[model samples]
Target: MILLLGGTTEAKEVACCLEAAGMPYIYSTRTEVKFEGKGVSRFGALNKEGLECFCFTNRISCIINACHPFAHELHHTVAAASLNIPKIRYERGFPERAQHELVHYIKDYSEALAWTENSGFTSMLALSGVQSIPHLRSFWQKHRCWFRILDRQYSKDFASRHSFPADYLLFGLPQEKEEEVTLFQKLNPDLILTKESGLNGKLDSKIEAAIACHIPILVIEKPELPRAYKLVHSQQELLHLFQHE
Candidate 1:
């Protein structure tokens, strides 16, 4: 049996493939985002102890990590938990490095905030999600900047605590290229801030949005992990690894 600690589409696909292959497996997700399959389990918060319990309970041998980037702590915990259990990470291909000559790439959020403020970006769109809000709040409060987030994910106090103007667009985005262009036209933002959540999270929409808006994007780079096996964007490679073993 295989234990998959996952929350992405890729993870769901892998779980489906494993099930079709007649392999027993369990899929773990922090949210109730439904995946079509039999015998798939969901966990609101997955931790090391829970992982061990699941593995032992099911007599599973291998652990698959389908979590996206910024799940650094989860990655380490999984690695440490598996002394005898083999672990595999289902990673999509990295983003194509399309260098924007006008855009500046920062090492982390702090650097991105500092550079955006120092660069005199009077108005900015904080599409880095609610997670990036705290870091940017200080500058926004002092600068009287503008930003937006999903109304479903955050509270009314979210903007109040941060001292930024709160307005809920509640706009549902389409995944088409032309639709992205239309959304970009609607936003008319001067700048966009986002993370490198690989290609799974409608990332192409963001890049296309930035292009259509003719604005610069501040992408937070992923860190180099320690003592890890890496792959270069190949599902066939992943298939081979799982199939041969």
Candidate 2:
């Protein structure tokens, strides 16, 4: 049996591939998001030791890691736990960095926040998600900022727990370029912030909207994955691994 670590859209793609191949697997997620795809669904965060125990108890022979690129800690935990098993990293294809004058790419959250502080952006729109609320607390506390989060109670409660202004939270995902432009016009923020979440994350739309509104945008680049796992970019590539087995 395979243990599939999933959370991103790529995870669902991986699950679909597995189902098509008639493979038995367990899809694990850190959150309680609905998984309509075929697989035995499980949810909860697990540490390295816990992961090893679960793998052993479940008779997991292979591991498919279709997690978000920025899930750095979980990547390490999976690598550590899958010492004697085959681990596959189903990575998403990222677009080339936008070279527009309004596009500024930062290394990570800390640096992104540092740039925001020194850049004199009075009002900002954050497309980075709910988890970033605490990371950018210093800037939001002092400036006029808004965060776009999932329209779920869990996300709202998370922002509330972080003491972020309820009124400042914008729900839902990134929209088409035209809709995004309308939102940008309405918000009229001094700056826009987002992550390098690839095509599935609708990064292009966000950048286009920011450019249309003549607003400077900051992009937090995706972090590097662990060298321990084998990486594949497509469903065919992932399924090909099991062809000889």
Candidate 3:
């Protein structure tokens, strides 16, 4: 049986392909969401040993790693466990370089916050998720920053627990470029903070709005993946691997 580590859009597409091909596999997710896909599924996380054990016990012939690009720790776990197995690292590629001059790419949240502090951006709009809120405590305390987060219970509870200003917590993801522009105008932020989520992240729309409003963007670059793993860019490539092996 194949083990498909899924969560992203590419993973869903791969799932559809697998279902169509009548492939026997198991889908794994880190979070507890309603998975409307086929095949058996296992929820929650696993350590390196646990992952290897699962692979061995379930007889996972191959692994399709379709987790979020930002999930670096999970990637490492997958890499370590799949050393002796056929593993496919599926990733949605990010741009080689930022197109706009105003786009300042930083290493992580801390550096992004530091950039904001150094740039004197008092009012900042953070498109990065709630997980990053804790790291930006000092920045939030100092500046009038608003966080755009998902409208989920855990998100709300975490924000509340962290003492993030209720009014400053904007729910829902940005949809279109025009919506982003409207949001930018409404916020009137001096700078915007976001992560490099690549094409799947709606990065272009946010960048377009930032460019239109003349607001500088502080982008936290994606984390590095493991070196010794077979990597694929698209669903087609992943499907090809499954077919061949």
Candidate 4:
């Protein structure tokens, strides 16, 4: 049996590839999501110990990691747990950093907050997701900021627990460039904040919208993955791994 850690679109593609190849696997996600793949679906976050125990009990032969790039804790846990198992990381292709004068690439959330503070960007629009609310709490609490997150009850509950103002919350993902332009115009923020989530994350639309509106945008770079796991960027590369196994 194989263990597939998934939650991203790339994960769905990998599941499809696995199915086409007639491979048997168990697909796992941190939370319950709507999945229509053939693999046995399981949900819940797992620690290093739990992962190892599960793999052992299920007779897992290989592990495919197709999680989001910013899933830092889960990536670390997977790296630490499956030392003996062959682990393959299905990575997303990140675009080259934009060289526009209005675009700034930040290393992480801490540095992003500092940049905003030093630059006197009080009113901002954040497209970095609900999980970032706590990370940037220091900046938002002292200034005017709006966060765009999934229009789900869980996301709202998360914001509530963090004491984030409900009125400042925007629901749903960024639309087309024209719609995004309208959003920027309506909000009229001092700056725009987003992650280096690659094309799949609609980074280009955000960049274009910011540029069209002449709003400076701060992009948080994706975190580096552990060197222990082998990385494959396409479905073909991921499927190739099983051939040798």
Clashes of each: 0, 0, 0, 0
Query: After aligning candidate 4 to the native by TM-score, how far in Å is the CA of 67 from where it should be?
Result: 0.7
Model 3, 1-245: lDDT tens per residue?
A: 88999877878887887888888889998876668888888888999988988989998888888887888888888877744878788788675666788888889987887787787778889998888889899988887989999888889999999999999999997667899999999989999998888878888788878998899988888888888668888767876776786
Worst-scoring 10-residue span by lDDT in model 2 = 236-245
Model 4: per-residue lDDT, tens digit, 172-232?
A: 9768789999999999999999999988888998999999999999999898898878899
lDDT (10s digit) by residue, model 2, range 12-108: 9988898988999999999888889878999999999899999999999999999888888999998877558888899998888899999999998
Tens digits of per-residue lDDT, candidate 1, 166-223, equal 5532224225567766755776656677677667666666776677668887777765
For each candidate in turn, the TM-score is 0.81, 0.97, 0.93, 0.96
Positional deviation of residue 71's Cα in model 2 after best superposition, in angstroms: 1.2
Q: Clashing residue pairs in candidate 2, if any?
A: none
Stretches off by above 4 angstroms in model 3 are 93-96
- Candidate 4: what lDDT? 0.91
Candidate 3 achieves a global lDDT of 0.84
Clashing pairs in 4: none
Question: Which of 2 and 3 is the better model by TM-score?
Answer: 2
List the candidate 1 regions with Cα displacement exceeding 4 Å.
142-174, 229-235
The lDDT values for all models are 0.66, 0.90, 0.84, 0.91
Per TM-score, the best of the predicted structures is: 2
On lDDT, the candidate that comes out on top is: 4
